[model samples]
Target chain A: MDENPATAPLPANGPLDGDPGLQPERTALAWGRTLLTLIAASAMSLRWLPDQGPFVLAMFGLTIAAGSGIYLTQRRRYRRSVEGIRAGRLAPDAAAVFWTAGACVALGAVGVWLVLS
Target chain B: MTVPSTSTPPPGSVPRRSRFAEKILPGGTEPDPRFTLANERTFLAWIRTSLALLAGGIAVEAFTTDVFPEPVRRGLSVLLLLLGMLLSAGSAIRWLRVESSLRSNRPLPLPLIGPLLAAGCAVAAAVVIAVVVLG
Candidate 1:
C-alpha cells in the first residue's frame, strides 16, 4: 500500500514534500484569523466601557498593536522553521512555553472570577 | 524463555528516523505526537479563555446599572479586555516557545506569569466582593 503523503516523512533538506504551500499558508492564516478575532473582541469590550473612553480606546489600540506584532513575529518564526527544515537545520523556539503557560494562568484567573462572581 | 529468530523488519517499516518526525521531534529521535498536540490544544484553549474574558467585560459594561458607577464599570471592562488580549497574545508566544523547545530537546520553560496572574486576580476579586458588599 502506498503511504499517505500527509503522514509520510520527507527526506531532510528537500522541499517540504507534503502539502507544501497549502499547509504552511493554512497554518499562518489560522494564526492571523485568531489574532483578528481577539482584536475584534477587545474592541467590542472597549466600546462597551463607559466614561473612560479615551483610556479604553488607548488600551484597545495597544492590544491591537501588540497583536499585530505577535502575528508578524509568528510569521517570521514559522517562515524560519520552514526554511530550516528545507535547509536541514530546524531549530526549536525557546520562548513558546512561557508564553503559553502565562496566557493559561491569566485566562484561568479570569475564568475563576467569572464563575465565582 | 524460548528464543525464536526472524530477520524480517516490522511491517510498517518506519525509517530509523524520518524527516517529519525529526521536525516534529528534532534531535534525531521521536517523541510522542500526543504531547505536541496537547500543547497546541492548550494554547487554543487559552485563546478561547481570552475571548470569554472580552465577552465578560463587554457584558459588564453594557448591562448593570448604578449598582456600580460608570467609571468603575469602564475600569473593569478595560481590565478584562486588556487581560484577554494579554492572555491570547501570551498563549501564542508560549506555544511557539514550547514547540521549539520540544524540537530542540530542552526542558520546558518555567511558568513565571502564573503567580502574577493569580495575585492580580485575587486583588480584582476582592475588590469586586467589596463593591458587592459595600454597595
Candidate 2:
C-alpha cells in the first residue's frame, strides 16, 4: 500500500511535557563556561610564545579549534536534546566529553613543556 | 528499528557510530536524563579546574621567571601543570563512573580524585609560601 508521508507531527514533546526543566540549556551553558575557561588559559599561556615557535602556535591552534568545535556544536546539541527530551532518551555524550578533556590534557602538556624548556 | 521492551534495554549495537562512546557509559539507560546532564556539567567543571591550574602554571612561570631561585620557580610551575593534567584526565573517568552508577541505580562512587587534587594544590601553594618566607 502506498501512503502519503508528509502529515506526521515533528518528533518533539510539547513544551510542558517535561515540567519546565532547562537541563539542556544549562548543560550548554556549562560547556560555555568550560570554553571560556579554556580560552582564558590559552591566552595566559600565549605570553610565553614570544620566542618559543611553532609548538606554542600549535597550542593556540588546539584551543581555538576546541573553542570553534564547541561553538559550532552548541545549536545542534540543543536541538537534538529537545527531541531527546521529548522522546525520553538522552544518551550520554561521552565522545564530546572525551575530546574536550583531551584538549585540556594537551594544553596542560604544552604548559609543562613551556615551563621546562 | 524497534527495540525489545525488556525492563533493561541494551545499548544500541551500532559501534561504528562512535567507538569512543561505545563503552564509556554502560548499564542501560539512565533512570533520569537530568542527572546525566548534571554529570556532564560536573565533568565540565573539573575541566575548568584543570584549565585554571594550567593558567596558574603559566602565570607563575611568566611573572616570576627571575624573582625566585630558578629551580624553585620552575618546580612550582611544573607541579601546577601536572595537577592540571591529572584533573583533565580524571574528569572523564569520574563522569563515566557516575553515569554508570546512575544508570544502575547505585549510590554515587566516592570522589577518589577530588580530594587528592585539592591536596596537590595545597602543596603547590605551600611551596610558594616557603619560598617567600625563606627569602
Candidate 3:
C-alpha cells in the first residue's frame, strides 16, 4: 500500500493526474455555473407564469426546491469525487443519469401538451 | 526517462503504445486535463439544453394564447411551467452523474435521456399538429 497520499493509487483515471486539485476545481466551477443558470431560469419562470396563479406558483416552487437539491448535490459530489480519488476506489453513479433523462422526457411531454392544448 | 512528478507534463499523456496501455490509458491513470474540460463542456451543453426547455415552456405559455382557446392557453401555461421544472431537475441530476464518473475513472455512463427526449418531442409535435389541423 502506498503510504504517501499524494502518490496514492487513484481510484480511477480522473481528470487531474499531475495536479489532483485542478480537476476538482474545474468540476466545482462547472457546477457553480449550472446553479446560477438554474436560479436565473427559475426566477424567469416565476415571473412569467400567467393568470393561472396557483399552477404557476406550484411549478415555481418545484423549481426552487429542485434548485436547492442541485446546489446541495453538487457540493456533495465534489467532496465525494475528491474522496474517491484519495481512496483509490471508483464509485458508480448510473442512477443520477437515469433520473435526469427521465425527468427531461416527462417535462418535454408536459410542455408539448401545454402548448398544443 | 524518469520525469519529476513536481513538474507537470506538457499536455495529454503520450498516446497509448500497447493493447494493455490502451485499456489502462482510458482508466488506469488519472484523467487528463483535456478530459476534465471536455466533461465540463458536456455539462454546460446539458445546462443549455435545460435552459432552452425552460425558455420554450415560458414562450409557449405566453405566446400561444394569441391563437389558442382560453382553456388551451391555460393548459399550455401549466404544461410549460411543469416542463421548466423537469428540465432544471434533469440537468442537475445529469451533472451529478457525470461528475461521479469522472472521479471514479470508470467508463462514462451511457446517456438514457436521448430516447425520452425524442419521444417527448414527438408527442409534443403530434399534439401541436392535431391542434392546428383540427382548428
Task: Specify the highest-lDDT model's number.
Answer: 2
DockQ scores for all predicted structures: 0.07, 0.43, 0.10
Model 1, stretches more than 4 Å misplaced? A1-117, B1-32
- The top-ranked prediction according to TM-score is 2
Poorly placed runs, candidate 3 (over 4 Å): A1-21, B1-44, B63-135
What tens digits encode model 3's per-residue C-alpha lDDT throughout B77-131?
Answer: 5554554556556555655565556656767776665555666566666767877
TM-score of each: 0.47, 0.85, 0.49
Clashing pairs in 3: A11-A88, A13-B29, A13-B31, A14-B31, A114-B76, A117-B72
Ranking by DockQ: 2, 3, 1
- Each candidate's B-chain TM-score, in sequence, is 0.70, 0.82, 0.67
> What shift in Å separates residue B5 of candidate 1 from its native position after superposition?
23
Q: Whose DockQ is greatest here?
A: 2
Interface RMSD of 2: 6.3
Cα RMSD, each candidate = 11.0, 5.0, 10.1
Better of 2 and 3 by DockQ: 2
Model 3 residue B69 distance off true place after TM-score fit, in angstroms: 12
